[model samples]
Target: MGLKKDYAALADQDRERIQRWSVLDEGEQAAILGDLISSPEMEALVDEALAANPDLQQTLLTLRIRQVQYRKTFGDRLPEIKGGYTAGKEEDTDPSYTGSLSIGWEVDLWRKLADESRAAGKDAAQQQALYQSARDTLGAEVMKAWLELIATQKNITIEKKRLGVLEKNEAFILGRYKNGLGTLEDLDSARTRTASSRASLEEYRENLARQRRALNSLLGREAGPALTLPADYPTVVPPLISLPAQTLKRRPDLKAAYLAIEAESLRASAAYKALLPSIDLEAAFEDVADTPGAALLTDPVWSVLAGLTAPLYQGGKLRAAAEISGMETAKAYQAYRETLLDAVNEVEDAVGQEQALKKQVRHINTALASARSNRLQYREKYRAGLAGMLDLLNVQEQTYDLEQQLNNLIHERLVNRIDLGLALGLGVKQ
Candidate 1:
């Protein structure tokens, strides 16, 4: 199957799991939420999740195993030693025992073993780089969850303020209606606006709760109270640099790609070397006894042997293997190039988004100011009986809409800032 198909399958599985848990009892849900909010083991839980998050943990374990494999491959250059004992007993025969020791080593005349070891080492390094890439991605995801939680809390606060303003306006309209200075239309419009604002407040509340749940889930827990953020969130523009070379060297994914290329290159070399002649030295010693009291050491025998292997004809299998290795090397190089291009595009996109959001924030601030002024003017005119209920309502709605837009712009700006930081691989404590 294709990569997208695999990802879709995994996502569908996760969605099913989420759906299954969503029907949990209220008390169970509360307990989970309480654990997220108050458990002192929260940090430990996060650590455990990281260690067991299937994809990441698999990469980490793969890297570790590859390192061991690489070490063992290199150890092939050292001597191999073996020792054993033999005993025999037969009817009408005394027991016999013998001990022997043997040692052998392969002489890497063409450095083929060393090259294969290098290839394995490169593979291990590539795996380590992939693990690092996974870790970086997880960190960015956590940051995104934290940011979403902050944005949701901000939305809730803004919604509350809006509801308060609507309530005050409603009270004013009610007072005017009671004094016979306002029509029922004005009171009804005010009541409707108040209800709309309250509805919006409740919507934000629900959204905030959902965002909290998602954040807590990322932390490997249930929903909890809203998290606090810095009073003034820091924003920094990413510095533009040489894209291709820098990304290839700096980005973990790109590094892994390059390492893969190196590994494939070495593997191809090793495959070609396999077609050449190889020499191995072998030595053995043995002791035998026919009786229990026999002197086995005095009856020892030793032998030394050396062998050379040259693949004269392997039914085209060796050539085919070499060809396959060459193709893999080519594929690895192409993948590396593609990864470098992707990194460059990501950096460019992040930079562009940051710039666009900054401009948007300025325009939003100007629009918000105008909206506030118009709302104030409409209120004055309505109080003086110079503006119709619809006119006042229109201005109030415009003000609220502008305020919401401004909040969204602020949130977008923050998100873009974080994205730029991620693109540059910044904001991570080394």
Candidate 2:
């Protein structure tokens, strides 16, 4: 209850037109991730990762265990029946048989047992939410790896093109130097640039291979064949431009934390009740006969017993336990608040990062345009004998460097968008 009130207050604190909570549609998850990256191959990868992830499997098992525990706790609220039979013939001509049956139930006058059962049920549900959260996280990781693979492949292509241009320039400079038309210094400079370009291209290729292997590992296919990835980046339309507080409310991790608070509160209530007196009712029957069947069917001795028990004194153990549970419940509340605050920060930070990256992309685009124009002018000047080849080469290098920068920035922005969607707790449809 405290967690919900805190959430409501946090959600209402922000007042802006876009800050207004948006109503999520039935297909909202699809819309968010689909707009981020609409690729069937990526979706399949995510599904495989979720299915094969051992950690997520462990979480599912944990959830099952929690459910079983809840069942056992609920069973405690009902009467318990036990039966026994004994047969012996010691220095006797015939064997004698005895049968006994007993049932006991603690009257829940204070609803203590009910609270414990409810607490166990809530704990199970919290585990379920944790499982969902794990699934969501695994899916996001797969998609992220997929995106990085595509971006690295594209970067490799860009670096190869750069290398090719540098090689051709090196060949031309070599030709001029042999004919005494260009100085040895120019020839060496061109060769150095070509070597650096080759080195950069190799680094990109190595990075691409590493990324592919990482993706494979995430899919639990370390020995699988190389993945055939698309060369072009997927078109992304960022969803939730106007992020609503409702989106945060849907985060499974947050729900798990909130459920923890409730479960702990109930447990604290049960612990406090443990300090009070408890009433128990027990009924038992016993019979003896020549046969076990006869022992059960014949008239028997029966007793109905009722007892009231209270914690007289145990060095203040019960009181200490109650106090501990109450403290634990309070800690759960604080934990929930901390988790909620962190989630909010992550979303806001991602949104701000996306905006900053977009602006950087725009500025880089303008600079790239200007650099292209300058490169063209330098080339013309070099041909007209008004500029040295070095000047043209420098401008060309500047242009290519800007192109590389723009490529990286664009991909960085796309990755940031993916992060933003994930931070909002959007799920993949797989």
lDDT of 1 at 36: 18
Estimate, for each residue in 339-396, the C-alpha lDDT of model 2 and write its tens digit.
7677777777776777778789999999999999998898788768789878878888
Estimate the overall C-alpha local distance difference test score of candidate 1.
0.67
What are the TM-scores, per candidate, against the unseen true structure?
0.79, 0.89
Runs off by more than 4 Å, candidate 2: 1-32, 383-385
Backbone clash pairs for candidate 2 read none
For candidate 1, write residues 173-242 as lDDT tens digits. Answer: 7887899988898788888888988888888888877776765666555444556554333332334333
Return the clash pairs for model 1, or none: none
The lowest-lDDT stretch of 10 consecutive residues in candidate 2 is: 21-30
* Candidates in order: C-alpha RMSD to true structure: 11.9, 3.9
